[model samples]
Target: MPPSLPPRRKSNTGVIVTVTLVAVLAVVGALTTVLVVMDDKKSNSVADSGYNYESQAPTPTRTYDPGPSSEAITPTQPPSAASSTPRATTRTTTTSTPSGPRPVLKTKDNPLFLGENGTNVVTCNLPKWQSTPTAAQAFFTAALPCLEAAWQPVMQRANLPYQRPKLVFPSGKRWSSGCGDVTEGEAAAFYCPPDGAIYMPFEGLNVQANKNMIGSYLSVFAHEFGHHIQALSGAMKAAYQQAYEVGPDTAAGLEISRREELQAQCFSGMWFAAAWNGKGSITDTVVRDMLEDGYQRGDDNNPSAPRDHGKRQNYGAWQKQGYEKNRTYQCNTYLAPASSVS
Candidate 1:
């Protein structure tokens, strides 16, 4: 219009300007989006239910303790010793003296610690296992009765009532649980407190662990089942309440988890050792196999992994403590030094 450039040239200049503006706006929008997302991530708390895994796997239905800090809490009354624990805490950390398989019934003052021997020689009649889910279920089924036989006497002496924990063998590539959803191989086996059952997904247990070796898997099962035992005793509840006070993901919080897990390991070892001593299938060779396999089952070796379970070395050591020592009192993980648990 001002008699400057040709019409075609002017039109081309306008198009270039339009494209430049659009590009500038796009860059600005992208930057703004990134900033917003970063801010949101920074603001999210651990209690947000955004995080998935927990130390209490089979994972506890994460009831975030939005309450007082661990140090601030006082111990409360526990459930009836024999009654089913209400969606209570599950796991261990601490050691009590193990009364040799036949010791005087302990007192309320001398509560029956995990490893204190109650009665002697109850053999678990377990079959050699196969890698299939059905076989695994059968193996656990057979083994549990033995555990009940082994542990009931201990509880009775303590005046604690014993209740059998329900068992579930999830049968699918993908499954949902009271704790959360599962992808193949995401969980090994867990004692979920919410449902009061032990979930050992045959597929999940077999994910890198299924060698048709009964002792190897049995070691883990006994540990989780030890959790069930802990639930039965007031010990499991006390441990959880302690953990809640400390904070589940924090260092102290993690120690509590490690202690709980390690104690369970000790309890399992005691069971196996007790079985080995009797007419049971747990041989020294089986114990050796389980110890070797346990190196792989440690829960918190990686940096990103939640520090719920102990190191691989500790896993072996704690389990060996129970098997070798075979004293229930020695199974107390809480009394051990921090380095021992860590």
Candidate 2:
């Protein structure tokens, strides 16, 4: 009562202050709404699935060709060649011979070597698969030489060194590799970097083709060799290492896997080009069949599939890009825009 002077008169200034506060809050709310909408739009624009088109392509006609028979069959007994011949203990590197398609063994005594802890090489004894085992080894052996001839010069031109990997045709329930033990069902063609070799059980190829025998078998070897080319190129290590460093969910991981797979496809295309150039037997029909077979094997959606190579459309487009252009640069799937190919 002593200090309560005249009640202070509320002025228009008070109302102005209240109005200004309300206006400021409204402006802040509006700005927040705009920001949230923009963020949503940006997120929606980045695609997670990328491009997939295997469903739209037409089915390809299947074909087969059994090559001429050879007498140099796989040995049924454990390899005696290495046992009888004195061998060098230290690892030896050898250059592929320049003239023809023949298996280039480090030492003539052992065209094939067992992994460090592996048992000696024994001839495949699986019933009904006897003759094919030798043929498969011979075919792969020949193919490796061809691949070396084709890729070495290309690699040298790119300022990279070429390291030839060994080819192992194991004919049993399991085979040991520098990487680890490869079981029967797990035995489609694969390149084990640790051992620097390509491995395949003859039966896996037979099963993949439903015993069709030729087209698919040749294509699988080519594809596996394609991976070997990648290993030699230093591209595979770079890609996989980058993916490992970055989490797989990140952009880098996806790009790395895409690049590795696509480059292998391109290498396979180069092989086709070489075949066309050398033998002159590679017809348009043959090319089409190869593409179709590759597409089927690479289909990613199939649950029981052995490899996550790619879908049919993806494989076909990449193969077409490599063959039609016939240039490694053209098959640069990692750098190319998604809209540029299927």
Candidate 3:
């Protein structure tokens, strides 16, 4: 009577049910995988918004070892026996020769060092000649203090302290500076932050003067001092940092250097403004002459030569901007438009 009873029940129902369950599971896994891929793509699309993937490579860090300390420098003899006398008196003598205009002698008060006034007056005595090493040192000393004075208020306004830098006057032959050894021919001017000092070889000033280029001498000091301003204002560190990130030869790197240099020229102008206002002695002719000389030395158009500094036109424009505006903000070549720098 129901031979069917045995087999009908156990028929293939169980096998079919097992197979259907397995197939449903497989389909669900495929859908899960597709959903996961879609979510990943959506996340990446959001992350890449407004970013140039190709050009946004990570910047490399720059490693630098601090340079050596400044060598011990001995003070040289003064132009006359003035070194021996205490409370020294400086006289300004004007001599009119067959030449167009003679150099004007200006006396500078003794420098105040380490909160002590005139401690090193004997060593700070300037030579008789305006272009002499003594004179250059004296000029630098005077200008250095003035620069500090000018920047002090500005820095203080920004809640920054004034850090004074040491000035080193080296002779022509061979001298040791914070940066390293410098020879007579290589004797331009430079600031070494590692040593916190500025190095100026008397021979460099003399050479420029002999070439009828005394203006270049002033510009050199201005440039070196400009470096000092950078050190104090954190501008120098920022520039180096930028250069390290962008590479020294890139457009950004060049812009950093140009900004520093142009600011120095502006500082030079500030000095002139102070001199003009206080003494009423710095004539427009003198400023023009100095500016022209600075331009000549700064010519960067010579592609064969090193274009790290700037061109003559660039120097002139920067100087003029500083002289006219007398404001630090205005002299900011880095932030200014290209047309302004040009």
Predicted model with the maximum lDDT: 1
Where is the poorest 10-residue window by lDDT in model 1? 21-30
Candidates 1 and 3, the one with greater TM-score: 1
Clashes of 3: 1
> Would you give me the overall lDDT of model 1?
0.48
| Number of the candidate with higher TM-score, 1 or 2 | 1
Please report how far candidate 3 places residue 170 from its true position, in Å. Answer: 1.2
lDDT of 2 by residue, 1-342 (tens): 111111212223221100000000000000000000001111100001111111111111111111121111112233343354443233335454343222222211221221111111111121122236786677567556656665565554433456787877777755565655544433344556656666656644544333433434445555556666555554555455555578533655554444445445554555555454343334344444555444333223233322123333454345444443344444445554432221
**Per-model C-alpha lDDT, please?**
0.48, 0.38, 0.38
Root-mean-square deviation of candidate 3: 34.4
Q: Per-residue CA lDDT of candidate 1, range 219-242, in tens?
A: 757776777666666566566566
Q: Rank the candidates by lDDT, best first.
A: 1, 2, 3
**Top-TM-score candidate index:** 1
Alpha-carbon lDDT of model 3: 0.38
